[model samples]
Target: MMRKVFSIIIFVFMLSIISTAYAKKVNKEINVVISVDKNRVEIGNHIRLTVGVEGAFDTDIPELSVPESFSLMYGPSVSTQTTIINNVVKVFRGFMYGFSPSENGKFEIGPVTLKYKGKRYTSNSINIEVVERTPFESTIDEGTDRSGKRVDINKMVFVELVTDKAEAYIYEEIIQSFKLYFQKGLPIDDLDYVAASTKSFLAEKLGDERRYEEVRDGILYNVIELRTALFPLVSGKIEIPPAKFKCNIIIRQQRNRGSMFEEFMGGGGRRYPVERSTEPVKLLIKQLPEVDKPEDFAGAVGKYTMDVLAKPAKVKIGDPITLSINIRGEGNIQTIGEPLLAPDGMNNFKDYDYETKVTITDRGDGIRGEKLFHKVIEPQSEDVDFIPGISFSYFDPDIETYKTLTHEPVPIEIEHSDIETPIRLSLESAGLAKGKVKILTKDILPLMTDLYSFKNQGVAIYKRPVLLSIIFLIPILIVVACVYVQRQRALLSNDVGYARKKHAMAHAQKHLSNARGLLQLDNPPEFYATLAGTILKHIADKLNVTSASVTSDNIYDILEKRGVSNEVIKGLRQCLESCDYGRFSSGQLSREQMESTLETAEKVIVQLEKQL
Candidate 1:
């Protein structure tokens, strides 16, 4: 019994020694360090800044100073990590920030300072280089990957801005294509596209997005292409701003679990955000050539053909005729002006303003459509034999000349009125004497002499209370309705912020319903995308800002400034992060998880609506 007791004492003493050693390791010296994901970045691109603290449990948030040229997009996302190895314990905590540079230059990010245990700790500063163009653009011809292998940037991911022609005449159709290329089998999601600004042109989307595969630099890649038809409004060197998009790429990492069950389950993954932009495009717009230009040119620039049809070939003098003129071809159909009446046809008939109808068809390659004009003409004289032909003149940019299309005159026969008018006779010519007429018939009954029988034949409707009330109420209602309608119109026209705020709830609900439908379809990616967009859009509408500008980093501050509670903001952040995980991660969520996420989103949005 004494031996067993001695053994117990030995075990207890050894455990105490081990525990003390572990405690000492856990209480290691505090160290802080600052670093950036990339030292070199392009203007308008984002960089990640992280400040990590080692062997610290309680520390104040770091105070970071960024250069004037850089702006804080979002951050201070907190992360914690703990590990135990060989009887040693280590603890780490980090605060991350996302920043974008507004100007191009070399700048220092920070020498972040943190306070812990009544002591101050300073982190090393990081240097960054911000260039006007992306590294991919400058290094396309010569670049080495991290593995020291020469690789083309286009093989991984890139964007291209292409135009059908570099130069075009004013009002000519120019097809602009924005294409995104990524390596085959790449996992990407949460795409936010920013279209190029075409303020100096009239632009129309050609069709839906097109997806296909192509080989570039002997590497296979998947491509998404969007096309737009742009018609230059002015003649000069016009610049189209670069188009941009942000997306998240999923990277799967394997884990050494040392167990078959854990290995079978799967490895985890992370999302890396990426932003790409196309180079700005420049186009020279020339004025339509003046040499050999048609006098009646109505600024129409495209290939076109016109057909004229006049109905009612047979008509009487002063009768009306309908002229149907159809101008159809490939071009800017909406801008085609009305054709003029022929001089020969104008003298013999009177014409009225023509009614116009335009139809556009997008054939995926270009813009093709037709414009129809309905004109009414009336014959004024019997000598008119045929309806005059109509002429349409337009400048054809392909041939670089003016062309006039003329239709043959429509033949018609006119007949004079055959009905004769009856003659009127005077009383004297009729030989009938005019005098005081005698009674034609006797009254059926003698008039009542009693005064009671002569009571008011009809009741006075104006004296009735209900009728008077209705009559007075109608005009008041009309005036109120008129005022209400005018106020709504004015608000919609002038106060965009008010309009958006008023409709924000409805728009959010609509998107939610769409997301729910997507959920039923078992498309988690699309559902999450829709839900995320709805939340961002709702806040943007309330704040009168663009949805693309909102991010997790800035939304907290944005909401807090408007007096939102921390609890609600945290809930929103969780919802956003869940949606992002659902979008880019390779793992599929269970139905129950998806439903819970959806419910949480609804609840948070409801809370936001009330506060906002």
Candidate 2:
């Protein structure tokens, strides 16, 4: 019994000794986390700081009470990490906070406290020295040449000017789009913008506010393009002034390391100051030549052709006729003048109403759009009259001559009415019958005939014959419903994805049509561009890939993965490559060659649809 008691006493003593050793080791270890960022720091400056804790404890930290000398921006980012190296586990825990000096001085951070395992652990007070910052060089132009133009340069306002052709006749269009990119990385209280003057140009602003991602040089910027259509006031050089603005940005920095885990999780780095923009930019413009300019030119340039379409070559009176004029050839489609209609007494047409729709290319072309005008007219007389022809005049830069389009006038034939009376009556013939009959007069009927006239009373209310029309509109609606239901049933019956592929087949055909149209119009560049864009957009939509990600290899990989036939896939790849070559090299494909491409795309779509 005494030996057992002695053994127990020795065991207790050994455990006590191990506990003391562990406590000593824990007291000696420390975990540190550092952070740096801006909060109430000086303008165009960043504030930095670090947070640390030294104790033998697993602690839940209370929030730090900051002083008036510094302003705390963000913090109390608590973290914990346990690392086992060589079986020796090191557990770290604490919170980090960032603050900036309100005024230039030495500011004390904290005697931050934490409680772990029923014990209080206090951090050593940290001192951050803040000093007045001297002016530094600008990132873009600091100590650069000031002799040229001293334009206010910064992030917000900038100008980009481009011309369709550097050399052209007067009235040729030169496009200049001014874009402004702005960002408030720091906390901003408020913001306002002011636009400067645009001189010596007819500026028509286009589009509402829009934001998009843009990369210039190597910097990624969120850009908003504010566009304006500019027509040169005179045939000479013109300079555009820069726009300007002022904005606020916050600055902060990490001071000290507090929790190592917080350091690792917070990107394992410190925060820094951010600066806002207070600058502007300028643009230089040059004008086209006035020499050898055509008289019919009204500022239309590049290459173009006018197409006119009118409905119902044969129609009766009181029928509404629709005229669709499409002026489709590249050059500046947006800036083209509205087609005019001449005055005629035959068809009493009202004033024309106008509307425009725009489609811009992925490449940096001038503009693409369709201008529409709607006109309503009524016939003034029953005589056969003609609707006057419209005149569309523009200068052909390639031909260097004025061209005028005089559309053929529409003729109307008014036929005499077939429903007419066979018998005729006269007052003298009625008198001969009256002499044979008894003539009677009422004495009560007084001679009040002066107050009323029976001369116009015998005329009929409606002299013209009315034709009956019983249109079976319900049957037409039923037919439409049948078509829609049949289409839906067909689509649903097939694999939905396969049906989608079949639809994509139409898009490929459309690309071929665009190519044919361009070739027939004698425009090789636009022919290839339209063909390439149509095919690329179609493929991208099919594979659910972004336009930027649709490279040739990626397309092939996607197609092969989808189990497309190797033969069809090869032909598709070849078509895309051909489009690319034609686009870049401006290679002209013959009509037969273009038709063959259409046939190839059709075959490929068919084969792929079957496989799918």
Candidate 3:
């Protein structure tokens, strides 16, 4: 037993030494590479440029000396990758950018340069050719598949941006959709979408992504679609920018030599990245007509009807009466303001600020929902007999006219309050006869007459050493507590990172509780989304970075660098991927699966708390 134990100790020591040597070697090596998704693109199209650094986690962003003809669209989406094989760990960081060319010409992008640990590394330069936009019909080409089947390459993959109307009134609901078409049997993954710019409109996601199969141009294809409801904010000629999408197409090839298991798995495949962009769309927005517009119109544009109700028809004066005004039937429900109450009719009531709640539902066609307003009003006097009528006005885009809906006054009965006021009186009002004061037998009791009572029964508390020590410690404890509170306040005010880290766990717990509540509702998508957000937000707070920029791709290296265990890291990755699947996939998850996911997430977070 002693010899076996000695061997185990020696083995552990040797393993540690080897790990340290490997870490040192990794720290000494650094590599930088820069590449673009495409070397040629049309003038209106954009290219993705990526700068990758290996063997290092912290490095300055590479700067590209862009030419005057090229414009930067969006950039520097950071992604981190970490891989461990045979106990060897490798770290990589990537920075990506989208660049659009203004004119047709050949341009050189870089010999990108990066600075790391006081050393400079350079990458090879890339040449890009920008050509004029080609007509859609002329862009199609014929190609052959692996089985020699004739295929239209352009028709194999494409994207389209469609709107229900090319022209609309201001604040009108317009359904805009983005559809991606790919050949039915082609394997596609890693879809990165950049939505069209909607700076001049109010946009809301309609619903979950729509997936189905369709036949286009006599070829069967699978389609993935996303929908948004947009309301134009201003009236004028507006040009909606083109939407961009990038995805990878997997191409399978047979391997020369491999194990039977590998062969059964179909060996491996290469990914071919493809990008597509839709043509720009122009829309003409007409201003709302000013003819016969309602005087109380609050810029509401939609079809709506109002219902006003007052509860508790019988009440005493000065008692609160709740007025529920519900406006239902669609179109920018969130932007709708509170309905106007007749001022003259409200003279007898004491009105307070009203609260509003909006409920919106996307029926896969357009935005339809209701806004409810709850106003509390108290009758000032018994003379008030009825609540005033409420009115709401909106432009009917279908009829091209302004319409007002009014509710009839709701009658109520008010009675005098039952409680009576107390009467106030002064000393003179009492009318009491004045008389000379007679002294009582004695104002104070005589001092303790018994000598035994005066004898000290116990030592005085102030005189005893133990008691005095306890009494003196009170102020010391108070001072210490005050100092601690002041230091905490100062830190919370001045140190952002410390404050975020301090509240990170509490915030995560709160969100987790909310997710738990969602679990009882049968809404798997929302529950998983909330759970995933909680984890990402917790890590973001710990690292003092924005939650929007934290993704599964980069989280591995981040946690690994922070010394998180491999088991916990893998569990976290699984949780996030499961959440992504639950959120976007059309299939439903079983209750047991959801419960297990939630448990796994909780465990991962608890483990992270110990290390992070």
Best by TM-score: 3
lDDT of 2 by residue, 393-465 (tens): 6766566666676677666554444433322244445555564543233322465546566556554535423
At residue 37, candidate 1 shows an lDDT of 50
Segments of candidate 1 deviating more than 4 angstroms = 1-155, 256-267, 418-612
lDDT of 1 at 610: 89
Model 1, C-alpha of 496: deviation from truth (Å): 16
Q: What C-alpha lDDT do the candidate models reach, one value each?
A: 0.78, 0.52, 0.79
Q: Name model 3 segments beyond 4 Å from true.
A: 1-153, 254-267, 418-612
Candidate 1 per-residue C-alpha lDDT over 1-612 given as tens digits, one digit per residue, 9 for 90 to 100:
999999999999999998788767876788887766556676776777778899875677899989988888888999777665444678899898999898888888668888776788887777788887534642322212222222224346689998999999999999999998876655565567889999999887797668897755333468889899999999999999999987765443433223432222222334567788999999999999888887778999889999888888888877889989999998889999988766867798888899999988665788899999998888888888888777788888888888988887788888887644333234343323233333322332344346576756687887688989999999999999999999999997679688888888899999999889888877787788789889988998888765534655457888999999999999998998898889767798988878888998999989998898
**TM of each candidate vs. truth:** 0.49, 0.34, 0.50
Clashes of each: 1, 30, 0
**What local lDDT score does residue 363 receive in model 3, on the 0 to 100 scale?**
53
Candidate number with greatest lDDT: 3
- Give a tens-digit lDDT track for model 3, residues 1-612: 999999999999999999788777566678877766556677766777778788877688887767788888899999776654445678899998999898998888778888777888887677888887664442322222332212224655899998999999999999899999987556665567899999999998887679797755334568889899999999999989999988766454433444433232233445567889999889999998888999889888888988888888899988899999999987999899779898898988999998999988655788999999999999988888788888889999988989999888899999877665333233443333224232322332344345566756887776799878888999999999999999999998688678888888899899999899888877787799899989998998887764533655457888999999999998998998788778766799999999999999999888887889
